[model samples]
Target chain A: MRRGIGFWTGLGFTLLISAFLILPVLASVIAGVTANQFVGLSSGLTTRWLVEVWANYGGTVLLSLRIALATLAVTLLIGIPAAYVLARHAGVTARLVEEALVMPVAVPGIATALGLILAYGAVGDLRASWLFILAGHVVFCLPFMLRSVLAVLLALDLKGLEEAARACGASWPQRFLGVVLPNVSGGVLAGSLMVVTLSLGEFNMTLLLHTPFTRTLPVGLADAYTALRTEMASAYTLIFFVLIVPLLSAMQWAASRAERLGR
Target chain B: MSVAIRLAGCGRTWPGGSIALHPLDLDIAAGETLVLLGPSGCGKTTLLRLIAGLEAPDAGGRVFFDGEDVTRLPIERRHVGMVFQSYALFPNMDVAGNIGYGLRVRGVARAAARRRVDEMLAMMRLDGLGGRRIEALSGGQRQRVALARAIAPRPRVLLLDEPLSALDARLREQLRQEIDALLRSLGITAVYVTHDQAEAMALGDRIAAMEKGRIAQIGTGRDLYHRPANDFVAGFVGDTNRLATPEGERLVRPEHLALRRSATGGFTVVQATFLGPVVRVLLRDAAGRELRADVPDEDVPAPGERVAVLFQGRSLETEAAASPA
Candidate 1:
């Protein structure tokens, strides 16, 4: 088929915007492997900067992974049931509660972290432990998990399915485990990916909440950029993308699979 | 095994005081198939849910299963099988998994559950399709899976709520016959709910015709057709024409009314519609009251012809007197 001028113009515009968005990330990736970012590609590529980054920030990376996984676990435990209740009630009260839960996401992360610190900082143990950082991550990541699960629940005939299960002699736990959980697997997958990725890269909130010993990857990345060589910071950025891209792709696959099953 | 059911003053009211079902008494003998037939929002589904233990009746109401009071029993303990209009099959499970879900939940062994699921698969004529996902099945096939799943656990009573309303007309008729045969072979007490009158007449051993949250009448198809207790049942069960008789207002079936051509008659034929088996002749009397008569195709009067209308049946008593007219 022959293309029209409008189609070509739109294509050009989209490509231009994509390049505009991706060019900096591409430069950072190239700089991560380059011998010296100041001299650009002519300086040649090497893995020394990546090795240096691992040697210096490996603890921060592991801490971020631990915090992200813990955040994922905490949010799933609390967010799923909260979403289920909200979806079932679905009245004025549910709307109010949902709005309140989403308030942290709507507010600036720094302000939310400040509020959390003020509320719990009086307790010396909580203020010093990595769990203090985990608490902030849970609050920040919960809305994503809840919203994803709630979307799936709202789309489903949950009451009808539950009644059918009940009529089949299944107990409440059986229905939840057998029917509700499996039906919402795609939503859970999508939410888990978002929570993990966001929690791993979260800087503003983590910076406010973290003790020196509890420094996360993004906080460490910021510190590396300010206090270390440019190539090392770029290597850290490259590492972050490497860790998150596969998870994002898995989420995409789950979304498409969900759409197919829905059809 | 089949079980008799009794609803003593069972009714339902929503949280805001809106009545969904008025308090009413009902009884179903073992192995009887009772159809609760009504239009949308007429409380037929609500009554069925009460019997299935999915809904609690209002205060002072009670439900019984085989002489045992189960009013407070939840659906999980009631052990009644239910089929919904949407088929409500678990999307995550294949046909065999869905059919065996109830048995599995009841602590049946995996091997036994598989055997029963296979038996149900064959019974529903879905022998080789047990491994197929729900999305892969046709509408009729999905309904079959749903039915198979509902009945696999051998519940005491079976409840179906507009189970065939979602299928196409040809499929609906075929499945309706299959359901009738299944109900008879199983000999399980079944409470079916639907808005379709033809379905009610075909499958119901006794049809409870409801209107505005109350049962207008309950009887066999013949009784409801020939001797409706009220005008609501009369008009709802079948097509009827209300005639202004000197004895008082009378309801007559269209088939029972005879139309004959005559000059200077009180009735004029306004429209003649040919409907293959019968020609429906519509007439307007001098009082501007419309009446319909289904006559043979060969003797159908043309439009604008004056005709004399004769009543073939006696006037039915108007006990309630407040018909939907």
Candidate 2:
């Protein structure tokens, strides 16, 4: 069959949009590998900038990874049960508590950081550690985790399933592990990936909370941009792409899988 | 083994003070099958949940299983098997896993649980489908798996909450027969809840017809069919036509009224539809009130024919044994 004008028009628009979004990232990566950013790709690509960035800033990358995983762990530990309780009760008090948990996401990140610092800055040791950065990330990421799991739990026949398990002689923990957790595993996975994704790229709050010794990837990227060469900064962006692109894809895939299962 | 159940002054009221059930006493003998029959919002399910220990009665209410008070115990300690209308089978598990879950919860050994699961699969006529996913089964097969899952641990009581309502008519009838046989063979105290009168009649040793949070009547199917306690029970348990007899208003089933062709009769046959063994005849009287009569195929009457409707069962309302309340 012959293609129609509508198909070509749609194809043209899509290509235009893709180029608009992807061309800049491609240009940056190409410049990072090139011998020099000023001469562009014709100067020949080299791994010199990449190696230099890794040598000087690799600790920031590892620090970010550690904080992201810790954020995920803390969210999973507290958020799943919180979401379950919130979804099941669904009273005015539960709704109010959910709104309070989500307040961090709604507030400006810098303001949230300020609030946390003022509240706990007197603890000198905690303030000077990477754990301070992690605390900020958790506060920002917990809302997403709660929303994801809460949506799944609400869509389920939770009461019926629990009652069925109860009648089958399953104790409280057994029912939770056997019936509740497995049913919402998809949501939990999606939420975990999302928390990690947000924590890795978190900048505004992390900037305020991080000490010089506790600097994260995003803070290091800012340092590379403002205080280092252009090619080194682009190399930092490339490193970030390497770290978080696959995580974003997995998060999208997991969310869609959860949606399909809900159907 | 079986258990006798007794509920003394069991009632339920929501937090906002809406009554779901009135304070009423009920007793089910050991190995008895009592079906709670009602329409939507009639509290039949609430009554069943009270017995299953999934719900608690109001103040001063007590539930006894084999004369042991269990009102404060939750459902997990009650050893009751419950089958839901939605077939709440865990989707993550296969058919065998679903059936064996209760067994494993009871600390049954691995080999014993597997063997019991197999026995339950065979009993439910799902022997070869044990490894299949819950989503892969049809509605009837899923409900059968739910039954197997509930009864695998051999609980003291079985509670079914509209277990066959989701299936088509033919499948429902087939499953109803299977459940009837299962209940009889198990010899376990069972409480069945459904809005379907035919299902209650077929499976219940005695059916409790509920209306407005009260037990309108509780009796055998024959007793309820032949002698309804009130208008609500009369209308609920079977199809009935209210007739303005000289003895005030009388309730009569279609089979109880016989039609005879009479040129001078005040009623005329509006239509006759063939329904397999029994043909349903619709008639309109002089006052335009409608009546129906179920007759054998050999006694077919043409539409628009004048006929006299006769009360065949009570014969002018003389038998108190077959009278309406």
Please provide, for model 2 over A144-180, each residue's C-alpha lDDT reduced to its tens digit, 9 standing for 90 to 100.
Answer: 9999999999989999889889999999999998889
Query: Model 2 over residues B186-224: C-alpha lDDT tens digits?
Result: 998999999999999999999999998999989999888
Model 1 ranges with Cα > 4 A deviation? A246-263, B317-325
Which docking class does model 1 fall in? medium
> Which CAPRI tier for candidate 2?
medium
Residue-level lDDT tens digits of model 1 in B189-271: 99999999999999999999999899999999888888888878888888888777775577888988888789977899999
Root mean square deviation (Cα) for candidate 2: 3.2
Per-residue lDDT of model 1, residues A7-94, tens digit only: 9999999999999999999999999999977888999999998899999898888899899989999999998999989989968989
In order, the Cα lDDT scores of the candidates are 0.91, 0.90
Backbone clashes for every candidate come to: 0, 0
